[model samples]
Every structure is written in structure tokens, then in C-alpha cells.
Target chain A: MKDSKKQYIRGEINKTGQSSSVGLIIRQKEPNNLETPFDQVDSFLTPMELFYIRSHFPTPKLELASYQLHVDGAVRNPLSLSYNELRDMPSETRVATLECAGNSRVFLIPQAEGAQWELGAVGNAEWTGVPLGALLERAGIEEHACEVVFEGADRGTPKELPIPPGPISYARSLPRDKAMQQEVLIAYQMNGHDLPQDHGYPVRAIVPGHYGMASVKWLTRIYTVREPFRGYWQTSDYGYWDYLDGKPVRRALAEMKLKSEIARPRVYETLAPNQAHTVFGAAWAGETEVTEVAVSIDGGQTWAQAEFLDPIQRHAWRRWKFDWLTPKKPGQYILLARAKDANGNVQPDQHDQNYGSYVINHPLPIEVFVDDLGRPGR
Target chain B: MKDSKKQYIRGEINKTGQSSSVGLIIRQKEPNNLETPFDQVDSFLTPMELFYIRSHFPTPKLELASYQLHVDGAVRNPLSLSYNELRDMPSETRVATLECAGNSRVFLIPQAEGAQWELGAVGNAEWTGVPLGALLERAGIEEHACEVVFEGADRGTPKELPIPPGPISYARSLPRDKAMQQEVLIAYQMNGHDLPQDHGYPVRAIVPGHYGMASVKWLTRIYTVREPFRGYWQTSDYGYWDYLDGKPVRRALAEMKLKSEIARPRVYETLAPNQAHTVFGAAWAGETEVTEVAVSIDGGQTWAQAEFLDPIQRHAWRRWKFDWLTPKKPGQYILLARAKDANGNVQPDQHDQNYGSYVINHPLPIEVFVDDLGRPGR
Candidate 1:
């Protein structure tokens, strides 16, 4: 590639066999000499290192011999699977995304509650594992069961709780139908390798179209229940709290709202006078497929439809690219990108109330410049 | 302290004399303890562990004997001070607060162009050192000097350029008055100890009210410039960009705005019905003192005055507290905290256009809960 200033640098194969365009957010912690290969991001797949790795406790070292997937409670035939057994099951592969409910939370002005995950908290993974439905069938879930709970192997540093027990590191769950979706999987591999420790190795459930919290990492136990599960990761924490009357009230978990992020034309890249280039980005939804992506060179006043890469399903992200011609004038410009889902839901400037660091279809803006090249008196 | 189910239970103090708060935002690399024995925080005085360490290049392991502060550039006396010589100067101490231009950046929703920092970029400390103005006086500043340039010990990694010749670490300048402020110290001591390795052990400047970038850590050189210093840290980066007709225009650096952070009442803390407690937090601004803090229980309807601790000075944060009585009704309530600086600049619900992240003064929403006590009839 020529080193001269160019319009855009698309992800291309490099000498090391890794994509050239994959940028590293933090160079400090990269592995010594190992380069992690990633599939074409194409707007959906988040590089594992870049993918949000949310851990209750620090990533634990586990041995496959001791790792077990236990199934009990409300199941006609309780079943347990060793790591190998689960890996041997007829594997199902699906391209889906897992986003933290608190993704892009730093953008939450007026500072809301929770972890300050700068923007990289969502990722697309091609998960290959046993179908959740098949696993439930083998376990013989009781006809009366209403919910299935997935637990992780992590044990958090405990804080105090009421008399008997305290804040434990665990997550629970919902309706049998929701748990049995074909998109849901009990996986041991992420992308193509054994899960990185930071990302639950051994095994974890990849529940497509939901928050990462729903996809319990370091999978350990699965339980069938007739009533709602109120574990710490569910009820008392992670849940939304409304600050009404000077206090917080817990709100039920809702499907994540739509969101998008621009990967190219990074914040302060200088452009030659009146230069034109194509801008690229990715957008995703919890369940709905992104149908269109709109790019606005003038903030949000006017927007032109950008090209959207077709999704493999309703759960994957759609990559979009907009061709931007050089501005006629030399000044600052805000590029706004907004994505609309198939349901006709256009991204909003901000989300409605229940927006506790959760969903927002707000259009993202990227500012660029057009210099006065002052070409020999034009 | 009685172990009550009502208030949060902070962890037991460790032998190191550090107390662990339930929700202190700490990096995995940092100690879990979160106690502040010192009341004031300097702009550049990040704790040895929490100090805002900016590394443009790789961190160098410098031997104490090899490190020296070089003072040259348009001066009658080009002097170099060994670490010991610097320590011998009349050491002055001040509490200053340094915020990155991008502090509270997550607030710039609709995703602004640039790095995403969720408020982790700000820190305070008690810095002790010789004044830069005094040092310049000893070195004899030239009459034509317009800007003072300071450089760090780091050599930035290679990337594309106009990028300014790097090994470029941190650098910044100030108008005459700021540079001459008696409080503007070339700090060598942090909290009564030799500056740690991560915090420019032998020396670094403590420029109150300026962004962290200006207080170059591992500082090594100080130069006077007749024109503005053309360095990457100064321009072509860090500057704000405006999207003018879809193009980016650079914005200038200015004073920071008033902003605050909730120290307690974390995101999903559950409240036992009818529990009374105090909501505590800290507020800061540049060039002004924090005068008053207000609490809003009903979103923004009515506001109540919060008790402000003793006022620090122009560039220090003033801790504030608000007592919230238990609500008669059981539900969710949003606790909003806003502060007004002595300049009468109150925290805004939303801020103006952000090119690169700049001062953020958005109101912080603390989600508190007033749980419903089960009724006897039920």
C-alpha cells in the first residue's frame, strides 16, 4: 500500500495473514508475539480482544477434567455433560452478536450507574456448539417448567448481604421457549479456537440477540424452573433502576435497543482539500435485522442511504458504507450515521426513559475536515 | 458500625490501611482498596497507582542516576537538575486536579468522533515540587518567548504523521499568567513520597486546571518557544473536531467546565423499605471554586441544597453530600446531583458541540432504590 494520504483504508490481508485494517485500541496489553486472527468483521464480528469481556470475577483457570455441565431441577431426567461430551454433540454454528447491556455506556451523558465501558462492549462471533434445544430435550425438561437458569463457574469477591447469604456471582433466567431458541448454544469454541480465558473457556452459552449477561460465561450449571429466577446477576443487579422520587426502582430486563458505531474516518484524521472518501461502520439489533443505514454529512438534517451488508439472520449486524465526496468549502463537518431495523424503527437522537445505560438508537457523529489545499491559485 | 441491611457495607480495612468500597471503579491492574486519607487531589496528582499515566511510546525503565531535568531554550542559564538537586529546591505542595480534555466523554452520545473514555481520564492528587516559573526565573526567560514547551521521558510508537516527530510523549503550554502561577510546580514528590515509576518518578509538572496531557509524566525537558509549539500532543491530535458539512474542523483547547461524579448510590443497589441515607459525591471545575451542590429527587422538578465541604481552590474538587430521607412510597427514584461553580456555571443537562472530547458538565443521575416492605395482609 502506498504511504501517501489516501481516501480510505479497507481491511485487507497482510503479510502475517491477519487483516491490515484491524486497529488495536490499546497497544499496552497485546500478547508478546502472538497475533490473533479475526474473520472479516464486515460490521458484525468483533475481534475477540476487542469484544467486550465482562467478568464477575477475574478469568479463572479451569481444567476440562473438573469442568462439568450439570442439569437438574424441574427436569424429568437430570443430565450432566463433561466438556468432551458437550463438544462432541452435533455442533451447530450461527453468526450472532452478544452485547453488554451497558455497551457504549460512557456515551451516557449525565453519568448513569454502572461500569464505564468505553464503546467496545459488543462483538459478533461465529459460535459452534450444541443446540440449546437439543440439550434441553436430552435433559428431559419437565412439561411444567417455565424458565431455565444458566450458571457460571466464577465466584466473585463477595460483598455483604442479609443474614444467611450475600451477593454471589451468578446469573439466572426465563421461559423455556426463549431458552430453547435454535440460536442459543452451549459452546466451547469462539470464532475457531478454544475460548480465551477472558471469554469463558471450557464452555458458555451463546444466546443470540440478547445482552452478554444473558450468555452466562464459564458455564457450570443449568436448571429448569417453574417460576422466574431472581439471582444476583438478574434481580438485584444488572437490572435497571429508575431514579423517581429520588430513589432507584428495579425494572425488568428488556430486549436491547438498536445501536451502531463508525470504525473508519476515526475522529481527527486530516483530509486533503475537497477530498472524497467512503465511510464504513456497523450496526446491530437484539432480535431485529438492520434494514438500512443512513449517513448524514450535515449532522442529522439530511441523510443519504448507505449500503448495508445483508445479515445472515435477524440477529446479526449489518455493515454499511457511505461514499462521501470532498466538501466544496474548507471547514469542519459532522458525519452522522443512523441505522434503521426491518421493523421500521429509526434510530432516535436519544432513547425513552427506561434508558438506564441500556438501549439507544442515537445516531453517531464523526467530525472530519476539508483543508484549503490552495492549489497554485486554483 | 452496625451491620445493617440498609446501608452499603464497605469491606474491612486491610493491613495496608486501605479500605475497599463496594463500587470503586478500579482497573484490574490496580489495588482494590479505595481510601482517600488526603482531602484534596491535585490536577496531576494521581495516586502512584491511579495517577493519570500517559505513555505515547513504550514505558522506559530509567535508572535514578541517569535521569535529569534539562532546562534549555532561549534562556541565559541553560541548567540541568539531577533528581537530588531538584529535590533540594524549596518544595512547594498544592492539591490540583488534572482532567484529560476527554474526561466525562461518554456523555457525548450520538457517538462523537474520537477515543471513548467514560470518565476514567480524570484524577486528583497532592503534588509537591519547585515552581516552573521560579525555575524559568533562574534560567532567565527570553523576552520574545511566547510559549513554554515541556516534554516527557517517553518516545511514542510510530504511526502515520505530520504526526509530529515522536518519541513524542506529553507536551503543553500556557499563556503567561498560567505559566507564572506560584502554584504551577515542577513536581517531584507525590503525597510525601518520591514520585513512583508510573508517575514520572524524578519530575513532572503539576499545572493546575489544565488537562492531564499538559502535565507530562516522566518529564525531561522544558523549552521556551517564540511561536506555539508544533507538537502532536499540542495539535493534529487532542484538539476538538467539528463536523462542518461532514468534514472535521479542529477546535481549540479551553478551560474545563464544572462536572461531578457520584461516589456512592451505585447503579443497582437495593434499598430495604424506608431506609434513610446520605448521597455523597465530589464536584470540580477549572478557574473556579465549587460553591454549591444541588440534588434533584424528581428528575429536574425541585432541587434541594446539598452540604458542601470546605471549598478547595480554583482547580480542586469540593466534596458534597446530600441527605435523602426514605420515601413513604415504595418504588424507583432517580437521584440527580448538580453542582454550581463559584463562577455560577451550573452543571448542564447537555453540553455543546464536542470536536475531540472536551470539558463535560452534565448532571450525574444516581439511581437509588426504596424497596417496598411486604405488607402484613399479603
Candidate 2:
């Protein structure tokens, strides 16, 4: 790679990743943001073909032979490593879930703008990559470094906003402490395969314990900033109200909020009356793992504990299932899934909309109907 | 106020109101926003000179001879009233406390934007006026009216904002129900005198139980709006987070928050050790009158009930006092006041800054020190 400024090109939208086999729900057509059918998620490791895809811009066309990840800015040693070089570095694979901040935006009353997504904009997968700390260590980080900013090759002027931003390379910055963590990865593979172009090609950031927006795709540059990054995306978009020194202010989006989704018995799905049924779902949290998944079968008036099918991992969502004997009477019933984190941060009945159109992690009311002719698990 | 737009002249600020007798603290100079020194508030009626002044623009200059109040918009009968005609209408006198939403903003950590007032941007004044409801009734308000907008003659392009709006009149709206309330006033007088230039001379709206902003000064136009008013003053400037159908959104600033201010033993005041001092203050709340005021002589660790000096009055602040004996060995002491409303809404230790520099109704910590040489009354 040459000068990033000179080589920067705002690529075109990817039209090839919408594979019919995955049956992924397309939240957006251009830039290719596809969601998995969360109800169909049957395993701990979300199949690569069925995993959710979120992109801020068009997929950049980069050749592996010439691809290089540049590590500079506030560093004693600035180095550029090729795709093979990154792959040859100390590698680790771990299962982590990535959920879009705006996952349940469709549930917001008065409807907020931007990606009206429901559930399925989340998935857990085994990401194979080199710890970002190793690359930063080799680059010899500076003491004054405060932020590790990641800039991707995908650059485009976002045309959706009233005042479009300048040509932006989908980027995000991590605090120096988070960047130094061994779990923070410069991922080269997804589910034991080379990074897919539909995702980030060659390499991308896999930020565990954070929202997917923090995981910059189509990686091209890693820079240590002496001060906090104030990019438009960091300040304007993908930010929420955070208190600093007891004053409410806009803060860059980070940690994914605790959430639980009822994968089975989907919203408005029909079920047979007086039949045995299984209610299954996935729960996830940031920083702390979700410790409890309670399924409420009566519009949150009463709750029944759900048993975890998948073993708990550091950053993976736990799959929980609840066995239910459908009521004999035919009527409308509301189902809700609520997750509690290790810190006792229970999913609130309502989320503070200060998060704007993002972090819509409130307990969703999924109204399902019971009818005599309806199938139990259709 | 004939042909308000044509007669609209954004008057220059009055420089003569900085009377030293009142000792009012000037928060802003050009547009004349003065805050009362709450510690000196010795009575329930905040003296005209001591009362706070909040203005978005310069003091509008108007001639009573030519003044005309226009009642239009969503009304069956649009009428204009002359100054004498409005004064001839059934006159009423009501004592109501008006408070700036940004009062006590200086206490906010990391600080917030707008006026950095340290309490005392409030005052209970005896308002002499005609009920705005009477004027609206004569105008025959349409059934579809959702809001009653009050527009003051004060008009200017607010220079402080990054995007200065086009020449705009200071305007705010009340819900249809609140507008028709007899307590809502159209005043041409203040404290037994013709309204002073600094305090909206010819006529103004005295929206009892609401913040001062809703009481539009220099009021020139009264209009019934079919939809909720989305003017910049109602939307951009004075707004707080409110939940509608369970979604947090920007809501126009309305009712003043419950508050208690220590009039005596003010912030950082020095007191003599082993001496008895009267801890006196005032407490006020909107819609609901303050039922109880608690004084904490040693910060908030312990509290003692305060006795009301003035009889409780609707829409008026209640003056409260507590007898406190200075600790014998006191080197430093923290004084705090907490008020609980009739609705049981107690003053919180911390206010939600989501109110955004407004509704700063937090229990303020007033640090006072005891010195052996300091005079007891000092």
C-alpha cells in the first residue's frame, strides 16, 4: 500500500454477497447489510453464510498480494504488514457475538430514522485473528497514546444524511486500554476462512464486548492518537448520551447493551392451542456475560426461567430454551425475553432513547396467537 | 404592537436596570439577563429590583398608545385589543413564582451550556393581569386548537447559536388545556406598577405554575395553533427529555422543577463557631405546591424539617427557615436544602442533566466554613 490518502478510493456497493442459500434478511440493499434469520440460528457458532453482515460503505476491492495494514501515529516504530504477514503472526480464534447498535429499532415508538431493523442483526461466530496488542507492541506504542483509531479501505461519501459527510473510510477508535487488550483482534479469518469481502477483506477489527460498529471492516490503517478521536462518526453518528463529570454529553458508541431475543415463537407467529412447544432464544451482554435468561409467557406479568443450551463463553451469547405447554384456550398471548447480566443490569422494560436509533435493547413484546389449526413450531 | 412584524423592532438592552440596591447578579450584559441574589431574598415577594430577569433578546420598546394585542390563528373570531381595552377587562392579581429553567446551572459538573446561574434566577412576584383565557374566549378558539402560542415583540437573530435563526420573536406555546386555565395571565402590570421595560412593559403572559419561558415577555400576539408549536424556542432552546408512549424524546420546557435554595448561610459563607444562626431559604414547585422543606445543616447525612414562614399559596414559593446552632468545633460545614412537593416528588441529590442545562433541580451542596474570628451574623 502507498500513501493511504492517495490510494483511498470510495468503492462501489457489493452486489454479490446476497446469497439465496443463507436466506439472510436484507435490511439495506446498497452497501449490503444482511441479517440472519435469528429464529433459524440452531447452533452456537452462527454459520458464516447465515451470519449477519453490516457495512457502512461499499466493499473495497483489495488484492491480497499488495494488501497492507499500516500501523503508525504516536508510535516509535511504524510498520506496514501484508495479509500473509498478519496471518503468520500469533493467531487465536474465539467465539464472540457482534450485534448492531440499532438492532431493535423497529420497536421504537414514533419511529427513529436509520435501518429499521428487528432481531437477527446479531450473530456469534469464531473469529480467527492476531491480537491487535501484538501488532501495536511490535510497532512500539507511545506513552502519550490515548486512542487506537482503525480506518478501513472502504471510503465513500454517505449520501443518506441531510448534510452528507466528507469521503469517509468506515472507521472507529478504541481507548488505549481497550486497544492493548489481548482479546482485541486484527482478525484475518471468520469461522476458519479468509476474511470475506462482504465483511472486511484481508483483515478487520474484531472488538469483543463492544457493539459491531467498533469493529472496523476492510482494515487499512491502525494509528495511535495522542488525544481522543473526534471524527464525525465518533462524535455525530454512532454516539449516545453518556455522563462525564456528572454532565450529560454525547459519547462515542461502544459496549453492546444486554439483550435477549425470542428466536422461536417469533412475533405474530401462530401456534396450535393445547400443544407442547419449545421457546428458544439467545442472550448477550457487553463487558459482563449474561447470567440469567427469563422467559415471560404472559406479557411480562409472569416469568419462567429458561435453561441454557450453549455453554457460557466470555463474549458469546448464551442460547436458552423454555419448554411450554400451550394454553387450551385460543387467544392472543404476549411473549417476552429478558436477560440479566452478571452486574445485575437487567434489561429494562424500556431503553433510554438518548441512544437515538441505536441500542434498542428493551424487552420486546412479541404478540403470538393461539389457534386450533395452527402448527406448534412452524 | 400594531402590525407586530412591521412594528417589530428588536430593542436594545436597558442599561439602567442594574440598580445596586437590588444587588441582582448580571448573568448576561447585552440582552440583560439578571439573576437575583437568592441569599438576600428576605421575603416571599421578591422585590422588583431583586427579582431575576431572563431575556432572549433586547428589551422591546413599545408605546402603550399604539399597542395592540392580536388574537389570531385557528380562531373563529380574530380580535385585536388595545392597551386600555385589555386594562379595562376584569383585572386579577395573583402571586406566582417564575423560575429560569437554567437556574443553578453553575453546579453542574463539567458544566453545561447557556447561563451558568448559581440559583436565584427565580422570584415570586404579585402579577396584575387579565386571564389569557378571557382573551382567547373572546377570539372564539377553534375546537382543533392543540396549542396556544404566545409571541413577544422581542425579536432578534440569536447570535450565540452556531446557526443564527432568521429574525425571530421570543415565542412559546401551552397545551390547549393549560392555555384555557384562568391562572394563565396576560399582564400589563408588575408589582402595582406599569410593567417595566426590563420586565416586558406593555403586556406579557404570566403562565402560573410553568417556567418563566412559557410566560412570554413583551407579549404581542396570541394565536391558537392546530398542532403543537415546533418553534425554535419551544424545540431547540428550551427542551427536556420526556417519554411519550414509552419513547424518550425532546419535549418543550414547561413546569418549573421542585427546588429549595438556602437564602441564609449561603454557599461558602463564613460563620462564627459556637453561635446560633438562622438557616432560612425558599422552596417552590410547579403545578404542585411544596408541602415540606427539609434543611440539612451537615450536608445530606441528616436533615431537620423547616417551618414555613409564609402561608402556602398556589403557584407561589413558600419561604422556610430552620434554627441551627453552629457546632462548637466546626471548621467546615455543608448546608443543604431539600423540598418535597405535595405529589411526594422529593428533591433529588442529582438531577438528570438530560434536561440539558435546564431544570437543574438538584440538591446543591453549599459548603460553609466556621472561623473563630468571623462574626456570627456575617
Best-matching candidate per lDDT: 2
Q: What is the per-residue lDDT of model 1 for residues B1-378, given as tens digits with 9 covering 90 to 100?
A: 222212222222111233333232332232121222221222223444544444455555677898788887778898898888887888789988777676556557666543445545666677899999988889999888777777777665334212222144556666556787888899987766777776676788888877766777778888776644434443345545333222222333646667776655655555555556666667778778788888887767889998875456668777677777757677787777788877777887876554334666688565666775564311
Report lDDT (Cα) of residue A111, candidate 1.
78
lDDT (Cα, tens digit) per residue for candidate 1, span A1-378? 132112122244211334345553431232211112222344245555545566666566779998789887788888888888888889988888777776666567777555555445667777889988888899899998888888777765333110113224455575688888888888887766678787888888888887777888888888887755544444334545342222222343646678777656656555555556767777887888777788888878898988865543767777777777868687888887887777999788874444445664577566777676555321
Q: Write the per-residue lDDT of candidate 2 for residues B1-378, one digit (tens) a residue.
A: 223212222112111234234477989997999998877666556667667999988888999899999999899999898999899999899999999888889998878778889878989888899998898889999999988888889988754221222466777889999988879889977777677788999899999899889999888888887756655565446755453222233457898888998877777878888777788788888998899999887778998999988887999999888878888885888889999998898997787855767888888888998887745343
Cα lDDT tens digits, model 2, A1-378, are 123212222112111333234478988998898888876766677767777888888778899899989999899999999888888888999888999888988889988778878898898888989899999999999999988888888887653211122365666789999898878999988877777788788789999989998899888999887766645465446756553222233467898889999888888888888778888889999778899999988999999888988777888999888888988888899999999989988998886855767888888888998887744443
**TM per prediction:** 0.45, 0.52
- Provide chain B TM-scores across all predictions: 0.81, 0.92
Poorest lDDT segment (10 consecutive residues) of candidate 2 chain A: A6-15
In angstroms, how far off is B348's CA in candidate 2?
Answer: 1.3
Q: Over the true interface residues, superposed, what is the Cα RMSD of model 1?
A: 26.2
